[model samples]
Target: MLKEELPPEAALDGPPPDADHVLQRTLGTVRRERHDAGRRRGRVMAATSTFMVAGALAGGVWLGQDTGDTVLRGTSAAGAHLAVQVTDTEGGLRLVATVDGVQGGEACWLVVHTKDGRTFTAGSWRANEDEVTLSGSAMVRAADVAGVSVMNHDRTPLITAG
Candidate 1:
């Protein structure tokens, strides 16, 4: 080891210089760091929780949505194509349909058949163009539906779904 000599002005004092201010500044810096760390942790936790809630809500909606399909397709006597999909709703069976090759100003009717041999006129529409899409509900159960038919205004069966 080597020894060095100190000048007269560099002699040690009774106590360390500025010790009080140094200790206070150090403690203040540590407190600020801790506070910032806590805030960051809180933000991370909040974000995670929000994502979890959103994910759970989305998952629930997806699980509760309808997944079954009861759809039938057929060609009409007048060279029209028809598709009818039935779904169970609160009041009855909901019908969603698409009909193509409809003549302008042609009146059409939807005929619903039940397993118990009951028939119902579910809905009707007047086609104004070549293609028509329609939706309606009827007092029939989807499970009890046996067939759906699209008929003309004269009661002629245009399309039949069996």
Candidate 2:
């Protein structure tokens, strides 16, 4: 409506529309907006988690096994599989091991068994999931290593690779 139709108290010259008055939203509209916001947050969280995991995996692949000179893969009757990348270093053997089909949180050691019947622990760690990748080093030279085994804390061999 034209300003001429305005009541005297509501004229354009009057004080600007109630400065302290707040706008109210309907209950359903508010609920819907909140729900939409929650959905957006959930999506963002999922994407961030995925990106972080992928970055970690790629970094490991680039820095670890992809640089190894030899890869020894093994399997066990118990359904466990282990792949070890063996790199011969002046100090000994550098081992990058990836194990699968194991229960999470099981304590395991990457033991390098030498040709002369000695065992050197390269690395030991508890499993995180069905699959895990880790690095360890043994004082024994790579040529002297007869085999590698993933051994349980109780001395059982979960998997072996030669």
Candidate 3:
């Protein structure tokens, strides 16, 4: 017959009278650990939210500034001249355009193209004379505008600016 060895502490008659107390202590430890984990999670979430808000504020401020870059300026083969200043605005690209040399009673269009393959109609006007001088504004993203072009109502390209 083989004999088994036992520790001195295992010489109890049966289960300890304090068994329930030990179980309660273990449960209390688990609960405290869970509470600590929840607090940590809440702190992490608050920090992330703060960072997001700061980033949003910074982006808003940046978008409100004027970039001051000229996107296009040229004279068409048919004698239509255009000058444009592109700026980044809160809404989008702010295009201030000046046009000259368009014939009177002719419909002209300003087209803006973006780097992301998007096109926008900025404005339109009717030239009153061959020496017509006019100014207009449009909204778009200065960073996204790849080029600008002036076209007639018949879709003929008058001038293109890059």
Give candidate 2's root-mean-square deviation (CA, Å). Answer: 14.6
On residues 3-36, what C-alpha lDDT tens digit does candidate 2 reach at each position? 7796555546754565323322354578899999
Best model per TM-score: 1
lDDT, model 1: 0.83
What are the models' TM-scores? Answer: 0.60, 0.56, 0.52
Q: Give the Cα lDDT of each candidate.
A: 0.83, 0.84, 0.75
Cα lDDT, model 1, residue 51: 100
Q: Please list all clashing residue pairs in model 3, or write none if there are none.
A: 92-140, 93-140, 93-141, 104-128, 104-129
lDDT of 3 by residue, 9-29 (tens): 254674355556666688789
Clashes of each: 0, 0, 5
The alpha-carbon deviation from the true structure for residue 3 of candidate 3, after best TM-score superposition, in angstroms, is: 99
Misplaced by over 4 Å in model 1 are 1-55, 58-66
Worst 10 residues of 3 by lDDT: 1-10
